[model samples]
Target: MAGIYLHIPFCKQACYYCDFHFSTSFKYKRELVDALVKEIHLQKNYLQGETIETIYFGGGTPSVLDESELNRLLAAIHANHTVASNAEITLEANPDDLDKAKVNALRKTDINRFSIGIQSFFDDDLLWMNRVHRGDEAESSVKRAQDAGFENITIDLIYGYPLLTDAKWKSNLNKAFELQVPHVSAYSMTVEPKTALASFISKKVYPPLNEQQSASQFMQLTDAMREKGFEHYEISNFCKPGHYSRHNTNYWRGVKYIGIGPSAHAYNGFTRQWNIPNNARYMQSVQQNIIPAEVEELTEENRLNEYIMTSLRTIWGLDLDRLNAIAGGSAPLLLKAARHHFDKGWISQHEKIIYLTQTGKLYADAIASDLFF
Candidate 1:
């Protein structure tokens, strides 16, 4: 089964730490949405007749679009593709965009899941991040959605910033737990180059994120969630049993997906393509019957490295038999290089499968790199 991802590239306000492509203006939103619809039709044949099992409406802020606007996009998708009856459809939202009326209206749509950008339930954290929503509104939004009969919900949290004390971090985790949110996506704050936070650090207006703080908080987060019976199913995502983000899991497992809108990416096992990142250019190109994207056909080495990178970050771990299929010598070399890590108890191997231990997950990216051919 395949998936579809739509990147809504407009945000009402920009967060200080974001590097994703977006426009803070709605001047061209309607036109861009139309371009996205057109792009969907143009790329409908990319996945070779695979049934869409997941449809993820992700972006600068998917909730920024209203009921009619969202309905139009969903209608376009249904008209062009064969979608599963119970496909997992997710919309990435913000706390400020969700209210009782909005939540009720959303429940009437085809979107069955929500990944709300709560970030933090603390006023100080929100201010530091320059987020538009406040602490009370964050808590209210979750409950409001739950009360509106939208139970399949997830919330995002950030840690390791200078102002986030250990106590505050602990409080943030407990708040999500108390609210009984089924899925939690907690990420350590890493300053991306060219973002506002990066400039702040460069100008000495803000301190840089400490690696130790991030590592410690991650350990804290994993322990707390596991204690509450939430599974650390992915590197940054934890969830109650049977509530994983099917859309993301599908991507990590290398299922083909087509991405629509500016700066969106698509993969079909052998090649990857990304649309142009400019809104106006994207619209013009779509109007002129062009995709305006770059494509790269994956080499054998690229496929192996890609598989190792994504699979190593999840609970499923790396499959040795598949590695052997890709290259007969790869599994043996990987096993030999990994022997020391197992000796150090940083990783565990059961038969042909290998997964990072809690301690090792902190350095998952680096370890996956080491294991790459």
Candidate 2:
């Protein structure tokens, strides 16, 4: 089974800290959707007939697309590919877009999951981040989605913002737990260069993030989540039993997936490709029956690094047995390098599986790289 991802490149407003490929103007919205539909047909065979088990509608804000447009895109995908009957279709939505009517409209489709972007539950944090939705709207949106019959819902939360105190961070997690939200994806706020947040900090318009505070909040999050009986299945994701995100899990497990739309990526377990980031250029190229993408053939080292990067972040640690076959018997070299961390109690090996300890998860990337052969 495989997956499909469609990037909607239109947003009503540019959040202060966002650096994703998007345009605030919807001048070419119709044209872009048409191009995306064509791209779907053009790339149908990319996954090589693997049953599509997941379909993800990701940013700039899939919620910005109307129900009719979304339906058209879904129809195009179904017409071209052999989608599984019980595929886990997800749409990444923002809080401002979820009204009773819109949520009801979404329920008419095959989308079984909703990943709402509710970055924070405080008004100050939302304002500082220039988010379009207010705190109350965030809560209301989730309520509406639930009322609309979306049982498999996930929310995105951000912590470590300069505006968030330790108490506020805990409150955010506590609110999600109160809501009985089965899945949650949280991220530490980081200022990317060229983002508005970076510019603001450079000019003293906004306070900079505190790394120590961020680390403390992450520890608080992990502990609170454990107490609430949520599984830290991935570094940034937690879920109740049986509520894990099948799409993202498939991604971390290294299943093949094709990503459509401008600036989206595709992987086939061998090579990776990404479309050009420019929307105008992408539409123009696809208009001429060409796919505007750059491809890279994966080398052994590249594949190993990728496996280390993704697998180490998940509850399923690196499988030494599978690594031996994929790495052509050089897997022991990787395991040998991991002994230092094992001795330090940062990671443990049991039944040939290597997993990061709670202490090790804080430095997950660093530990994974150290074990890279």
Candidate 3:
């Protein structure tokens, strides 16, 4: 089975730290939606007839689209592909956009799950991030969704920023627990180049991020989630039993998926491709029944490295047997490369299955790269 991700590349306003492709103008909103529907039809054969088990509406903010727009896109998919009867359909939303009326409107659609962007429950922090929603709205949005009988919910939280003190971080986690969200995805604040936050730090207008503080907060998060009976399933994701994000889990497992929209990406085991990031250009190309995208055929090394990077970050450790199946005689070289980490007690091997120790997760990316063939 495969998955489908629709990238809605429109936002009400830009977050200070976000660098994802998006436009604040609604000048081409109707045109863009039309193009997205067409792209769904055009990319119908991309997944090669794998049953779509998950459909995710991710973006700048999928909540920006109204009921008809969303349904039109979903209808296009239903017409073009074979979707699973019990497929997990997710919509990523900003808190401010999920008011009572909006929540009720969403209930009319097939969106069974929500991934709310509640970066913080602190009004000051929200302002610092240039987020349009206030702290109060974040809490209310989740409650509204629940009140409307949508229980499959997850929230996104940010940590390690200058304004997020350890005490505040703890409070944030406590609030999330109080909200009773089934899954939580928290990320450390990284000031990507060309974002507003990066410029502020470069100009000395804002203090630089503190790694020590980030590590402390991350530990705090893990400990709190574990105490609350949540499973730390991935490096930055925690969930209650059987409540993981199906779409993201499939991605980590290297399942095939087709991404529909400008700036979206798709992978089908052997090759990966991404749509053009420009709104006008994408719409124009789709008008001519063309998918303006670049493709890359995976080399053996690329496939191995991709597996190593994605698998090592999950509760499912890198499978040595699978590695050998990918390329015979590859496991011995990987084991040799992982020897130093084992000595450092950062990883442990049991019956040929390797798992990251709590300490190893702190340097997951670095360690994965080290073990890459």
Q: In TM-score terms, which candidate is top?
A: 3
Q: Per model, state how many residue pairs clash.
A: 0, 0, 0
TM accuracy, model 3: 0.99
TM-scores of the candidates are: 0.98, 0.98, 0.99
Off by over 4 Å in 3: none
Candidate 2 clashes between residue pairs 3 or more apart in a chain or in different chains: none
Each model's lDDT: 0.92, 0.91, 0.94
| lDDT tens readout by residue for model 1, 83-102 | 99999999999999998889
lDDT score at residue 205, model 2, on the 0-100 scale: 95
Looking at candidate 1, the ten consecutive residues that score lowest on lDDT are 337-346
Backbone clash pairs for candidate 3 read: none
Q: lDDT tens string, model 2, 1-373?
A: 9999999998989999999999999999999999999999999888999989999999899999888999999999999999999999999999999999899999888889999999998998999999999999999899999988898999999988888988999889888988889999999898999999999999999988887887888899999999999999999999999889999998898999999999999999889999999999999999998998999998887888788888889999888887876778767898789888988888988897888998888888889878776
Judged by lDDT against the true structure, how good is candidate 1?
0.92
Per-residue error at 306 for model 1, in Å?
0.8
Over 318-372, each residue of candidate 3 has an lDDT whose tens digit, in order, gives 8999999899999999999999999999988878788899988899999998999
Candidate 2 lDDT for residue 259: 92
Ranking by lDDT: 3, 1, 2
Candidate 1 regions exceeding 4 Å error are none
